[model samples]
Target chain A: MKASARLVVGLDPHGNSVVRVLRSQSPLTLVPARRVGPVALVHLVSSVTSPLGGDSLELTVEVGPGASLDLRGVAATLMLPGPTGLPSSSVLRFSVEGSVRYVPEPTVVTSRAHHTAVVEAELDGHAELLLREVLVLGRVGESAGTLSTSVRATRCGKPLLHQQLVVGSPSIDSSAAGLAGKRVVGTSLMLDAVPRASDGGEWWNVVPLAAGGTLATALGDDVVTVTRVLDAI
Target chain B: MLTALILADSRFPGGGHVHSGGLEEAAARGLVTDEPSLKSFLHGRLLTTGLLAAGFAAAAARGEDLELLDAELDARTPSPAQREASRAQGRGMLRAARRAWPSERLAALSRDPHQPLVIGVLVGDPYEAALTCAYLAVSGPASAAVRLLGLDPFGVNAIVAALPVEDVASRAVKELPALGSPALDLLAEAHVRREGVRLFGS
Candidate 1:
């Protein structure tokens, strides 16, 4: 299965943010709020069981100057394998001249599932973006399959953050130098003008990126613990 | 080839021994204690961080722009401590390379280039540079484990010998890798903040 979704948000003359374009395909539903405000809220709902093997999904979001958008997910996504045994992939591209906050639910990589997720965000000088991701290895008492997720954010054509994380290799997954045997991994990336001091604990830390922005990473045995760390950041 | 070997050597005076590549933090937390655990740690390091560094080194050896690679590497390494450690080691290596293998290309590098870039510029061969980087990634940590945990040197040597450094190097030469080690990044940050008698820099 192949799906593509697009969303465009812009600021109106009345100083209100409005959705100019909303295109949704199967398994990629977009719901917008009816109220008019400074920020436009959109909920992303999966209309069908998706991301099965051999599935390819793409989502493109564009935010015009002086506009703000908040995109949220309604439920968790389960990555399952299809009968063909092919791999699944998803690409999210964001072109922002204003601000965008994408908060999606956790994604669980079930057994025999192989998925590759990529997120590319291109921001202008005054643009800002906040992205959060939490990945669970598998269901309770189960082992993960395989997942390769990468995020690349560029500001004014300069790279801000580029990281690719691969999970489900038993040796690396359980090794201290890898995931440290943690079942859950979470990361929160904030690319704004706010300056935050570096802080962390034994398993979590919020640190400043090299170019600009702040990244908070947490590894825990459960989703709640990891989510709490990301929230606190 | 000699340049790669000399840089990989512990006695090269490149100041590579001070950074444990997060092994110190992992050991401090008791995550790695025995031979079996050390093997796992080295293997994991070889696959993730090791592969990433090797890829950058290979790109540099292939004559990629030093400044661009530096910025891209910075984007890949989100932890400040890890970045500082790499630059510090790079500075040390540059100092030595200026006296030994001085060249216009070596001089073109920034004052404090990433360690892998330095290795790549000196080696000038993608595969060899990648191999040198992949080996150094786990070798330092393996030695640090022996010093910090009182593990047997022979056992640690065996573990290091068994790592997949060549395989990682071969793969790294194929393309630039952005593999991020979450546990290693967290450990690097925590190591910097730990308030105690720390032996390694990172």
Candidate 2:
């Protein structure tokens, strides 16, 4: 009983929200039970019924400017071994609208669970975007499972941020120089917000922001500088 | 031997200790704050921006024309902040390499330097050369993060363990996708105008 789910979110002529879901080879899948609203949340679950071995759950969302959207999964996906006994994989595609804020929590990849995702966004001139994507080595205390994840953030047909991560060893500990030496790692990048430079001949300096834990460094004469933030520390 | 080490060291006095590859501005806006967020940021940068830049540097090391490589890098970088950062670091790296290993190739390239141009003249192996430079690019920011985050020594190792080096050699290329983040350039411009700042030139 394996299944594949496809959910599409779009903006209407008036800029209202519209959501659609196509499950398997069935007819047009529409959520009459749940109509689209200002803030839309859509979840499509694919089960262990496919010939490909493991199940897949994909989430797609479209957030308009001045609106919000959160698309979550039904449960933490477990990639069971295929008929050949190898781990299974899934693909997640996310397309964001202009002026919308999209934040998807850390996706937990159990031992041997391989997932690949492509996130593309086209933001308007005045839009603001704050997003965080995390792939854990394994289940927290237990430390079992492997996760491979890829992310791409784009604007106006160009790419902003793209990354691929694979974690085969959950329990094994290595140096921070490798991944800042943390079990949990996150990245926060902002565009169009150039930091102000200091006087003197030097072009860059690290300064503490309003928050005690946060640090801001303005480098060079460009309009943007992304600060590295480690959530675990 | 010492030439290789100097080019790879994070503390090479090349003024690379500044700039966070868009991390500083991202953090200021609350895009990234803690360990989890920082890791995510690094991962994305390495795969997209880091991957693309390494590829070009590798080509340069392999004897690609210095002018051609510099032009390639210039065209690939879309944002002003990133452009400035690349040139600033390139100039600094060229200056340092000239002093550390003063050879005909290094001296000639240093006259008008760019990141890939200097790297092509100094690095021995195309593959390893790119990896070493890429490592410095990632390591410099990560080290800066240590100072910015006030991270514990033990925790620092944890971060290092997270970077994947196995496939970096093959991934280094001159024409990877462009990782264009306009906000990063915006921040760099603003930083330059501000007075009494502490970081190096972008």
Candidate 3:
């Protein structure tokens, strides 16, 4: 039992305030297609209306020259089992000419659920991007499943960042790279700009990407503290 | 295998000693204050960063583009402090590698190429390259644990010897998924900023 979901949002400038969302799709699939407001000024605005879990999910987002957009995920996704204990997979591809912000809600790795997601983005010289992800091992008192993630981003066709994360399950010794013992973990990345945090808190571990970008990682005993640190960007 | 053995030696002057690979930071935060904790720390690192580095190292050993491999590595590394530490060591390693291997590939890299990329280019076999990378990834930290926590040297060595380095490399070569540790990343960021006596570079 393998189900699939796909969403493609293409944004181009129509006027100073309103941008055109040339492509938007959330066809009838296991993962719900839900969104609202391509509201003015900052290109198009869209989001995943509900929590999602499927055998495979593919997302392609394109921002036209000088356009800016924000893609949000409303609730955290739980990686439930597919038909035959098959792994859940999500592939996100981005083609950006201007800039894009993707701040999705956390995805919980429940017991026995194995999920892997890959994010690939190609950006123009002037384009910028912001991506944030949070992973929770269990709900209240439970061991975590397995979640593997990969990110590949390019600027002007040059690779800017290629990052990978595999956590939980196999390593019964320590859960989720040892961070689960402390509870929650999150990653925030910003390209072509510095992450300005008004809090000035010491919660985040920050770094500068070689070509051009910023990466930060934070953790907390609870989800709120970790999410709060990620929200700094 | 001989080349990997020589390079994997912490004494190869590749600047591997300068980095704690996040161990110093973790130990300070109380995440790794004891022997069992240290083992878990090393194991976690091996499964994530170690695996990824080995994967890239193995890929690089397969005659991949030097520039392309380094760029891909940059994309994979999300921590700035760790990134800087990597470049610093890379620069040091490149300098040493050029003198030893002295190839056109070594010369093509920028002033400070990444350490794994340098090792990848010089190693003859992908598995060897990966094993070398994986070995060093934890060996450096295990040594650091001895200095910082004054843990039994014998115990630390035992942990290193007990690791599934071969399995990690094999899986890495098969599919190196992107994985990161926010808690460790935070520790690294903090370690660099910590004012008092710092033992290792990263």
Candidate 4:
């Protein structure tokens, strides 16, 4: 069970990026991966160096005041199998300070990989944030790996959104319960704002958004809006 | 079995009803209406927003330190209004737990207060707590869907049946994100200000 992980730090808007890579013969630890700045990007990469097994990794993101950070990925993440043929896992902790927003793209898990990822965020007054996550089961014909996810959002030390998901033996077409029997899964949430228009029907409305590539839905005011695409994969 | 049934019940007094789980806003915006549309909307939410919160609850159930859980939830939840809403529901549930469970752990957690914290104290098994949290979160909106859209009760149940609860619970334990969307946070904050809103909380 040999593994390697790299933490890359970047501050967008400033157009500066610094990345740190760490490798472990066993599991990867998050203590070394730290980001500092009003706006910074902490990127991480973990790989099972030894083919005979798999390993687990943990990462944390700490955000300071009035900072705007957008964490994007170079590619979809691939989770390898362990020596026992189970998927490896990762945990993410986001520590937020005054008025900073952290947005990261969704995560994709390759086939036959069994992994779980948890994300927790703590916020303060006058602070803001945005989060987006996506998970893919398998590659082509091979068994799409299983992925489990959980997310928590808080303000002034309280809980906002706590969510979890587990997808096992994912297939291209699943039933309503199984990705609604769809292939790709995505969701977006906007916290406390009133909707500009309620004419659509309930407080929430869905817009086609760009003919086909994007599908957007407006929920509540704007504080809590969700946009998702199963076909987006 | 009893724990499963009690926790799974919509009327468990968990204060879950107060939250539309973003459904109120989604429906108000007309993203969801009637049964099928509500099902689709909820399915999307369960995978995304709902998944995130459920994960926190599951982690809390796993007995991660309370202060650590508190810090994590703060970072994940970006909206001020949403934060109030979660704490409101958590506080409400804690009050209810005192009357229902009344265990020392529940009592201690209630003193400080948070939904996941209270749940962690009450539930002995991490998996069971995850299931309970997911059940409460998902079903709250399902019930709201019926009233908001006047959907058929049977169809609502059908949709509920289609939702992957176990999957949601397990996933909640794994793969949840820690990013906040400003666009949505702003909306939720505004939603909380509305005085005549029909929902329980913001």
Give me the candidate number with maximum lDDT: 1
lDDT of 1 by residue, B140-200 (tens): 9999998999999998898788788899999999989999999999999999989979999
The residue pairs found clashing in candidate 3 are A161-B75, A162-B75, A162-B76, A163-B76, A164-B178, A164-B179, A165-B178, A165-B179, A207-B80, A208-B80
* Better candidate number, 1 or 4, judged by TM-score: 1
lDDT of 3 by residue, B27-94 (tens): 77777888888888888888777887888888878877777777777777766676788788778888
By lDDT, the candidates rank as 1, 3, 4, 2
Error of 4 at B142 (Å): 1.2
Instruction: Say what the interface RMSD of candidate 3 is.
Output: 3.0
Q: Which 10 consecutive positions of candidate 3 chain B have the poorest summed lDDT?
A: B176-185
**Each model's TM-score, in the order given?**
0.99, 0.52, 0.85, 0.51
lDDT of each: 0.95, 0.49, 0.71, 0.54
Q: TM-score of B chain for each model?
A: 0.99, 0.83, 0.95, 0.85
Best by TM-score: 1
Instruction: Please say which candidate is ahead in TM-score: 1 or 3.
Output: 1
lDDT for residue A11 in candidate 3, whole number 0-100: 43
What TM-score would you give candidate 1 relative to the actual structure?
0.99
Per-model DockQ: 0.95, 0.09, 0.53, 0.08
Candidate 2, B1-202: lDDT as tens digits: 4555677776677777776665554454454567766665555455545666677777767776666556545544534446667777788887777667777766556354556557656776767776766666566656666666765646655765667643654667434433332233334544455556445454
In the order shown, the candidates' Cα RMSDs to the true structure are 0.7, 10.9, 4.1, 10.3
- Which scores greater on TM-score, model 1 or model 2? 1
